[model samples]
Target: MFEGHGVNRSAAERRAASLTTRRSVKKAHQAAWLVNAIRCIDLTTLSGDDTEGRVRRLCAKARQPLAQHIVEALGLGVVTVGAVCVYPTMVPHAARALRGTGIPVASVATGFPAGLMPLHLRLEEIRWAVDQGADEIDIVITREHVMTQNWSALYDEVAAMREACGPAHLKAILATGDLSTLRNVHAASVVAMQAGADFIKTSTGKEGVNATLPVSLVMIRALRDYGEATGHRVGFKPAGGMKSAKEAIAWQILMKEELGRDWLEPDLFRFGASSMLGDIERQLEHHITGRYAASHRHSPA
Candidate 1:
């Protein structure tokens, strides 16, 4: 259905740039926005050195992303991240850690960062993660399919992965940085949603470039159009290289502007960032006290 679709990079860039300059939220409103961003964050850790210890720690942080002081000072209650994301093997640890907390454990499957593996193996990985208690699966798409304009192949692959996920929500990561064009990014977003992706993500946080606003604009527009055409609402996630409260607020503003406040919720939008929580906490702390504290006071995520 996305054949011959085109995107204007210059127009997307201009619009993305305007999101930062055109809107401003301060004091209580900014603090509320930051807290909402926390609710929609996929607090992630996907390194070669990832261990159960580290995963447990990350899950602990996800359970209580902000300090008690911050939560109390802000007059908020029961704050937690949307989910804790980790490798397939770490799913069990994350699940065990977050059990009964109502926080889903998300795993990256289908050969994340690069989906160059055999299709069956990739599908199997999804089932394995689900069996290990991953409530959500983030699967990477084969950039080759998009680059070669093989929309059918991409659709079939994602559909198979969706089935393999069983009951887990499927998040298709387009990794737009590798797609080479906004047009490709738009097409991939539509195909992934057509293939039953519950959410369409921008990156795996391991690309040469990840989650730029311009690329994200293209994907968001594609999903918006798909929703209009099919009556299905898909979620959006922009992962990687976003590490500031300003960025957290900017992306939320983009979603709110483009798709309204419905997209601002955790169910419809998320930031696939690991280190972003620290900066958000810092900003909220400053809002509470009218001064910034040392960064180390906020624990790493």
Candidate 2:
């Protein structure tokens, strides 16, 4: 298996910068790419005031992310988000709302956002969410372990969380922003995958800094290296701060460039986003009708 490796920040920065300056997709191709992005979104509502009603509405949007006219115009059929992500308490509502849609309900557990709770409590949260019908569980790693270079503890923590998830897929949120360096991001990626993370994610969307191109590059590289060593493909998610259709395309391009076209699918990549769908809808509308719709017109609610 591949252990943690060193990352040359300067080289990674140059590559990440090139991702933007390179030629972009246009017209029909751009519209298709945005549709693919829509299918890979973990339509999320992580607000403190989130209620069952709100989660149900979010699930409804996840089931039919695009308007009927837009779907017909684009020649796309029944496009849905990759999944619906909600807090543990609202998992049942999301599950019920998304029934028969085949869109999984992903719950953020393990004392999400700021994961400073006791280990036992965190583990129980995972089991509880799984029991509540979450098909996927996104858990946060103890930043202290990564900060202090306690690879053993970090690996063990994630491994246990994976077990607690039972049949539910495990997504280890590295909270890369708080790790403080690209090297730390790389190391955490390796450890999390080693500990059986199905997907390694960037942020909780509440950090001082969240997902950025440079940081995503480091994580993707680590994922590639790990796949090479173990022959196991791990997924990548860039959550938080990705609000525009342009940002979604940039990340899709990154996955296509770094890991090949296979990583572009919902099984291998996901955008933890809420409002992103609206912009993508607008862009897709412009692609079809030669005009952009107002934001309110494409609201998920």
Task: Give me the candidate number with maximum TM-score.
Answer: 1
**Index of the highest-lDDT prediction:** 1
Task: Please report how far candidate 1 places residue 182 from its true position, in Å.
Answer: 0.6
Which consecutive 10 residues in model 1 have the weakest lDDT in total? 1-10
| Residue-pair clashes, model 2 | 0
The 10-residue segment with the lowest total lDDT in model 2: 1-10
Q: Could you give candidate 2's per-residue lDDT for residues 68-163 as a string of tens digits?
A: 999998777789999999999999999899888899999999999899999999999999999999999999999999999999999999999999
Model 1 misplaced regions, further than 4 Å: none
Reference-based lDDT, each prediction = 0.93, 0.92
TM-score, prediction 1: 0.99
- Report RMSD (Å) for each prediction in the order shown: 0.8, 1.2
